[model samples]
Target: MDNEKVRLQLYMARCGVASRRKCEEIISQGRVSVNGSVVIQPGTKVDDDDRVTMDGRLIKPTRKNIYIALHKPSKFLCSNEDPDGRSLAIDLISPVIKQRLFNVGRLDYLTSGLIFFTNDGDFAKKMTHPSSHVEKEYVVTTKKEIPEELMENFKKGIYVGGEFFKMKSYKLNGTNSVNIVLEEGKNRELRKVFQSQNINVKKVHRIRIGNVKLTGINSGHFRHLSEREIKSLLRDSSSKNGKYNNKGNRHNIK
Candidate 1:
C-alpha cells in the first residue's frame, strides 16, 4: 500500500457507490467487505489491488468509465437496487452495462427528466461538488398560479435548510409553469422552495445539465454522452485541465 491512502467511504463514493455519508452508513451496516473479510469501518484504507465488495458483488476500479444521460420517467428510483422492488433507473438500462454504475446525483421517485449515471467516481464527485458550480435547468409545474413576489424572492435568494438557496434564473412559461435554473442540487430543492411558500409543486423535469440537454430522447430512455459532451461538462464544471475557465457554475451551456 502507498503511504497516501484514501478512506474506504471516500473511495466508494468516488466509485459511484454512494455519497461519502451514505457510504459510511452502508459500512456501519456491515455491507462492505475487503480481501474476503467483512469490513464495517468507513475510514479503512484500501490499496490498488484490494478486492472490495458490497453485498457480495465485486466493485472494481472503473476501468472504462461509462457516462450516460437518461430521460428518466416518473416512478423510478435513481438507485441500483430497490428493496421494495420498485423499478430502478439502472434496470431500465441494459444489463450489458456490467459495471457497477450509479446515478451521479438523484431525482427522487416523482421528479423526472434529465438525470445522469456514471462509473467514473471522480467525475461524479467533481460534478456534484459545490465548487463545480454546475447549472441544473428544470421545468416545474405548480398546482396553482405563482405569486408575483416569487420571482423577486427567488432572485434575492431564500433561506432553505439553513443556507440561502437561490435561483440563478427563471422564466415564466405559463400561468402555472416555469423554467428555472439552479446552481445547486439540493434534495428535492424545487419542491422545498415552493413548499416553503405554501405553493404546491406538481411536477419537476430536469431539462439540461451543463451544455447537454434532453432533445428527441423519449421518456424512459438513455443514451451514452459523446466524448465532446463529456469534455464540455468537465470544462464547464471547472478548468479541470485548463481547457476552459469560468467564474461560477451558475453559467448555462451555450
Candidate 2:
C-alpha cells in the first residue's frame, strides 16, 4: 500500500496504539521507529510494508476491525496511560484481541458503564461526530433532590460557557436519581449541567446508546456489539423521531 501511504500519527491511531494526538507525543518522544529509523515527526508517512515499533514493541493494525462495548467500572481512567498511576480501563482488556483499540468516547474516572472501544478509526470518528447525534442514556444518582424547575429548564435547554446543553428526556427515579438521555453529549456536559444547577451528583452510569443497553454484561467486563446494534447506531442517529421510546425496540433514533 505504498500508494496509500499515510501520516505516522494516523497510522499509529489506526493500529489502536492511541488517539492521533497521543501518537504525536509518542512520535516526538522518539519511541516510534519506521524501517529501522526513529520517527519524530507526526507528518512522516509510512506504507503497509514499513516496519513500525513503539517503545521497541511492534505496532500494527489487525486484519479485522473490532467493536467492543465495555461495562466500565468507576475509578478507571479511559486512557492508555495515566500519569498518576491510577487504574486505566485498558488494563482490564484481554490481549487476545488482534489489534490495538481506542475508546470511542471518554467516561470519567468516576463514571462507569457502556463505553465503546474500536480499531476502525473511521467508525470512531463517524460515531463521535456531532452530526451523527448518537444518543446516550445515563442513570445518575444525585446527592440532593432535584429542583422542580430543573426538569423544565432541561427540556428548554441550558447554556454554559456559551455552549448549549439540553436533555432529550429525563425520568425521575425514586427521590434522588434520574435517567437522562442525551443527544451527542459534549465533554462533561452532564456534570456541567448538574453542577451549574448546584446539584451534587453522586454517581453517573451510562446505560444505553442507540438500542444497546447495559443489561447482559457484568461491571468491568466487555462484550462484542451485535451487527444489528452497530447498524442501529448508524440508522437511529439519522431518524427524525425526536424522542425516546424505551418501551419498544422498534423505535427510531432522532
Candidate 3:
C-alpha cells in the first residue's frame, strides 16, 4: 500500500506557519486554501501533487527535515515575529539551517533554557501532543525558600488561577533553588504555579526534556539531535498508568 497523504495542518507546521493546533485554527478561519479553494477541515489530506496556499500565497513543502536543540538565551521571544520588534528565537539559529524550522514549544522572554526547533512535522506533532506526556525538567531559582508545606502542597497538586497545577516531581536542590518536572507545557506554568504559592521566581532554566539533557550545551548555541536520540524520543511517547515506560524500563522524568 502507498503511504497515506500527510494531514494539511502537519504540512502547514512543516512550512513554519505555526503549531499544528494553530494551523487548525487558521484553517477553520478560512485563511488556508488548497487548489484554489479554502480548507476548514483539520483532517484534510494533501499529497505531493497538491498545491497549497496560505493567505493567497503558495506554500511549498520543505524537502529537508532539520532538528536542533537551542540553548535559548533570555530576552528572546520564542516566535517568528514580535510587534514590539524584539529579537526572535529564529535569529539565534545559523542561516544555513534556519530556513523552515520552528520552535516546538515556547519559552518565556525572561526564561532561558533548552528549546527544540525542527522542520519535521511528524516528529513535532508526536513530541508536542498532550497524550505523548513528555517530561520537561526545569531548574528554578526562587527569591524565597520553598517551604516544606508548600512542597507537600505541590505533591498534592495545588489549584491556581482556576486550574489545578501539579508537578510530576519536585525537590529543593539548594537553599533557594528547586528542580521540578511537569508533563504539561502550559504558558508560564512554572512561574504562575510558584506565584500562586507566594514564591518569587528569580530564574527558570529548562534542564531536560524526556531523556534528552542540556549537558555541555552552552547558552546561545544549538546542536542538531542525532538519529538515535530521535528514535529514543519516539519510543518513549506512550504513558501507562501515569508512568512512562521505555523498553520495559520505567522512567518518570515527568
- TM-scores vs. true structure, each candidate: 0.81, 0.79, 0.87
lDDT of 2 by residue, 44-163 (tens): 988788899998888776567788999999999998788899998877775656557889879998999999888866567667755566778999899989775786787677787788
Residues 1-254, candidate 1: write the lDDT tens digits.
23346888877766667667678999999999999998988889986678889999877555577888999999999876779999889887757577667788889799999988886767787778766668889999999897758867886777876756678888998789999988766777778888888899989999999889998779988899999999999887776323224444443221
When sorted by TM-score, best at the front, the candidate numbers are 3, 1, 2
Residue lDDT tens for model 3, 144-203:
987877767876677777877778878789778889888866778788877987899999
Worst lDDT window (10 residues) for model 2? 245-254
Candidate 2, residue 17: the lDDT equals: 73
Q: Which lDDT value does model 1 have at 132?
A: 69
Q: Could you give the candidate ranking by lDDT, starting with the highest?
A: 3, 2, 1
- List the global CA lDDT of all models: 0.80, 0.80, 0.81
Q: Mind sharing the TM-score for model 2?
A: 0.79
